[model samples]
Target: MDFDQVRLHLNAYKENDQVIDAAKYLLYSFDLEHENFAGFGLRKAIPNLFLLITEGELGEPQKVMIPPNLFDFDLNLVLNVIAHEMLHVRQKSSINTVEDKNEREFQAYYEMLFHKVFPKIPNASDFHKKIFADKAFEYYRRMGENSELQQKYAAQKKEIEQLISILL
Candidate 1:
């Protein structure tokens, strides 16, 4: 889907004008200039899985995969999911390793939910923080034990933090 379709979806689920306005701001914050970045699309491969698959082993453009049967899924929910997956693609390009995959996913989910999406809706960040914090701690704890993974995670984390600090 294109950005306009994504925006339409966002508008459908978002009733609050203020929340929608904030989401528009967040959407603009995403790195949309990347050549590899594409909007969401539906697939029939899985029954109910909404996956975002990137090209190649790494350093590939990201593709958001949504099941065709997402009629029941809320529009903003799908947008957030796509945003989270795109974060993973960004992390993967910066850090190379299989072990870092899980950590990157955790970091992306946490950062997107807490830093990006939370400001858009009332109490959304507060509710998601509890979830994100637990997952971030677990990922961080694992990274501490795995020296190689720690190095990779730290590098990617620093890169992401710097990018966010500079751009957002």
Candidate 2:
């Protein structure tokens, strides 16, 4: 959906502090760096809705595509996905290996869940909480404490904490 439609829907649910906070945070974060990338924008032209991140062809423009269906999608979930992808951008800037990319994505997904998504949807089902918590714990354990991986994880944790505070 376009920004206006999204704003209208959000205004309709204005009394929902959690929803309002989540939407504001997502929009604010997107605004901070959405344009620096080579390609970035919401795409309503496809059948299967998705968020796309692509490298520009022949030095063209890199982009991020957000499908229109995202407006009807869960706000917290969509924000988490966007935050996770944004973390990927950071990871791309620092890490080169496929393994590192996967690891960072794992960490980003956890960070988004615990910090960005969970606070906005505290009443999520027990199963949902268990799944994310388990994955996060598993990722942390695999990184091993006191290692560089753990240090990066800790930094991400701090960043998540700060972002949460800002949104709250």
Candidate 3:
């Protein structure tokens, strides 16, 4: 879908140069056009976050929700947040299952933590770093301690790690 056509949804569609510029940059840098998304949308009243909305029989990604004020953040930070949500879009469309929420979070956060592209950005503030530490390492730390959850998710973790390598 054309990024220019991203729906304003409930938002009153005021023209924002920042959103337009960032959309252009994202289009150039990522494989967004072919994803199984219904479209992109803008939400004005919600928290300042991006979201991937899923639907249909398999719960695949249907649309990406962008807060209208998202572009007010630092550009790198804005891109990173959008990239994170896009990763969710990819995970939902490719995996087609809502199960393994932990695995999914792990994979996405792993990318944010270790991937070369994601790591060099200066916008990953301490708050984000804290979440990355707490959530991303939860399963790996458990496995190291011999938690049974380790056994439950071992193969899946390995698969996700491999996928992370590819995504990186």
Among these predicted structures, which one has the highest lDDT?
A: 3
User: Estimated TM-score per prediction?
Assistant: 0.50, 0.46, 0.56
Q: List the residue pairs that clash in candidate 3.
A: none
Give the Å shift of residue 35 in candidate 3.
2.2
Candidate 1's C-alpha lDDT? Answer: 0.51
Candidate 1 lDDT, 52-115, residue by residue in tens: 4544446655555545444344444545554665565565453453336567765665655455
Clashes of each: 0, 9, 0
Identify the runs in model 3 with alpha carbons over 4 angstroms from their true place: 1-21, 30-34, 46-61, 94-98, 116-123, 138-168
Runs of candidate 1 with Cα error greater than 4 angstroms are 1-33, 38-41, 45-55, 94-99, 116-128, 146-168
Give the per-residue lDDT of model 2 (tens digit) for 52-101: 45333322333445554554555545655666555454444423322454
Tens digits of lDDT, candidate 3, 56-124: 333554566666566545554555555565556666775554355566566666555554434433335
**Which is the better candidate, 1 or 3, if ranked by TM-score?**
3
- Residue 103 lDDT (model 3): 60
Pairs that collide in candidate 2 are 1-68, 38-61, 38-62, 39-62, 39-63, 39-64, 40-63, 40-64, 42-66
Report how far residue 129 has shifted in candidate 2, in Å.
Answer: 4.2
Candidate 1 — which pairs collide? Answer: none
C-alpha local distance difference test of each model = 0.51, 0.50, 0.52
